[model samples]
Target chain A: MVTMQNYDNIEYLSETIRVCIKRRFGDDCEIANIALATLGGSNRTVLFNVVRGSYPLRLVLRQETVPSEYSPFLPSDMQYRVLEVVYEHGIPVPRPLFELEAADNLGQGYVVTAVPGETLPKRLINSAEYVTMRARFLQQSAEILAKLHTIDHVLVPGLSALQESSDPLGAQIALYDRYGEPHPAIEFAFRYLAKYEPEHGAKNFLHGDFRNGNMIVGTEGIRVLLDWECAHTGSVMEEIGWFCARSWRFGRVDLAAGGFGDRETFYRAYEKASGNLVDRESSRWWEIFGVMRWAIYNIMQSHGHLSRERRSPAFAACGRNTGIIEYDLLKIIAKEFD
Target chain B: MIWSARMFNDPPNASELLLTVREYIEQLLPDLERQDKYHGLCCTYLLDVVMRELEEPPNIGDHSNNALKALLNNKDELSETEFMSSLCASIRRGDQDGNLDRLLILLTSHVSKKVRVSNPDYLDTKDYL
Candidate 1:
């Protein structure tokens, strides 16, 4: 595995990609236009083009730069397998390419065919250019999620390792305990979710972080879903609740459905598409779960910075951001808490 | 107390210093590459956090501490982190279920004060706040 220090050497990175491309395709394979993507925080995302014979492929190489033992994200190979399975099922995800093997010495990661579109939530919501996307976003997102939840978890063998289906709330509580940062609001929400655990909901394949920023939005809306590292088998409503969580809404709190439209519209579209009844009460429970998960994410990033595992200003901000998220979580669960 | 604090600290106080650096980064952002620009934005956000903290220190004063103290009756000597941690254990153990209504209020108030320091704009939820 290549250390991140050497990972930053563009010449070395380009050579590594070239070798991987040659190994996957043939000696004639030519890799070009390799550039690092600027958006994501945890992964080192690179955009490049590869050509062999008459075929041209624009690809994304997502490398796990900040590896942590206590992290909740699935291993890189598992994430790749999930993407392959989802793509095979006709989900609108990027086409998975070859995984970087141990021999490649570039560390753990994989390549996928890049999809075109803007992913920034603020721009997608506020821009006039995205008016069409905004109009179609709710229906499109709901339809995609509906399709995603319909996929058989048996198709992805790696998913069986995840225990989220058996006890989703317990799995999250265990994750929070592993992080070991205590928050009264998170503790309260944990109890609330445990006490009011939804009695009925089919366990379905979920895009564990299906929200605005994780999808690509063009004029049509939702070109492809990205980030399958958090994929798990869990209650279908968990996916819905995560999508509608206020943290993912950016500044458009009014538009609960990923800052694109109303929750009612999204729920109706999803219900119509998935053939599953929209459980509003259960959805509220999952929404609280989603908010607590967001707060836990903040703590994880903050700990990463504080513990000197991977220090950055962005991560340091997450420490304070946890407090902001806690306020949101408490407000949402206040009625039930009382 | 006789002299202005600004005179001893020099012209650029902590807030002004952060503001100047943040302004410089903002001006330099356009020229940087996309990756560098993203980092520059993160730097600006961190600087803003510092400025906010300097302008409005965390309002977990005696009143808030007392609220936390009241919740964990035996932990009068505990610091804020200890108090919160103890409260978390109590909540997890269901020992605080009877007092949840009161606990919720205290936790909400404390987190609200935190929000005021971290990002006050978040508290301006038009629908809820």
Candidate 2:
């Protein structure tokens, strides 16, 4: 509901947001410290301090950005609904407050209580403050993902069975084709995957972008899992593979589990949590698929910059990262073959 | 002065110039904040890649074609790009199902060549294979 005129001014938007909060929490609520949150690339997140009566609250307002070709087709409302369901199910997600009303004159999105922690992967891995948690990071992450996968898909509104469940390799090829440019390396990976398609497993909730950078970590452990926009119904192994993907390791290829621990430690923790045996072969296949997916996404990000859909030096650098991902993909596949 | 057409050998080659710029940016990176720092780091990395490309351009085409030729066991008039595209198509069509090993070898060789140019460090650290 953001009008064209007031949309560009943060101060005006803050006052308007104050009015909306006043409507919800009565006129006793006061909003202040309206500042932008740093990490979200696809959405605009605003952090604000809310004083309601005698209590103070830290909250986040996530507003959907203008959709581009790269934006996931899933609605922002769907994400909010998913967050609500996940939080209800004891998941470590920010507590969902409420979705914005059209009458509020703010753009589409919702409000949630902000989790107190950091999401920066470099800091999480290297900072002295997080040293105590690093040893248990892999097991903690695995446990969270295992719990997430156990959530009944029927419980989440707007959640649908993944099309990839039927033909995992073909779906990726089709997606790449949709991008309208032929990448010989990616095409080669696709063919390789198709030729050696892994045995299908039971479908579950796949946290499509599960990685260290998306998790908010504190001294205790993982505070909350963030970025649920890519959530979908697929193989549980898909989430595992994605979490262990080389790119997610953040340059520490030595530590397989998001640069925190070895693959066995992560797999063992997940198996223990979910009561499901880990299929090493199938998991490895999905790992390769994860790398390829990341490579394709890097290209898409670069294309966004190159095509002027979004002009960012980071996107251009992401395009170059496709090479490193391809290198890892080849290395992993070759090692598997041997 | 002899009137002869010739290409000049420049003192500051493309790689050298890119390295200089990358170094300068790397020095200034400490001053940047938040988004600017992130973008500055990316720019520095991009320059590094461009420098690497100039110094050691990948010949993946030749490596891929050679591998493909061996796998197909036939010498044809198809260009390298055409052959690669056709190979991908054939694999997609399940024509290579019977020869998965050969396909793996070809792909590994091609991708390895690319890695050599894109990031030789990957090859150096990856001793698993």
Using DockQ as the measure, which candidate wins?
1
User: Per-prediction DockQ scores?
Assistant: 0.69, 0.39
Fnat computed for model 1: 0.83
Q: Which ten residues in a row have the lowest lDDT in candidate 2 chain B?
A: B1-10
**Docking class of predicted structure 2:** acceptable
Candidate that would win on TM-score: 1
Best by lDDT: 1
lDDT of 1 by residue, A274-330 (tens): 888889888878888888988988888888789776566778888989988888888
**Candidate 2: where is the Cα deviation over 4 Å?**
A1-34, A38-41, A51-56, A66-73, A101-106, A162-167, A336-338, B1-24, B57-87, B96-106, B112-118, B125-129
* Model 1 per-residue lDDT tens digits across residues B1-129: 112234566766767778999999999999998678877888898888777667663433457668777767783577757767888898999998888778777777777777776777767453123
Model 1 chain B: weakest 10-residue lDDT segment is B1-10
Could you tell me which residue pairs clash in candidate 1? none
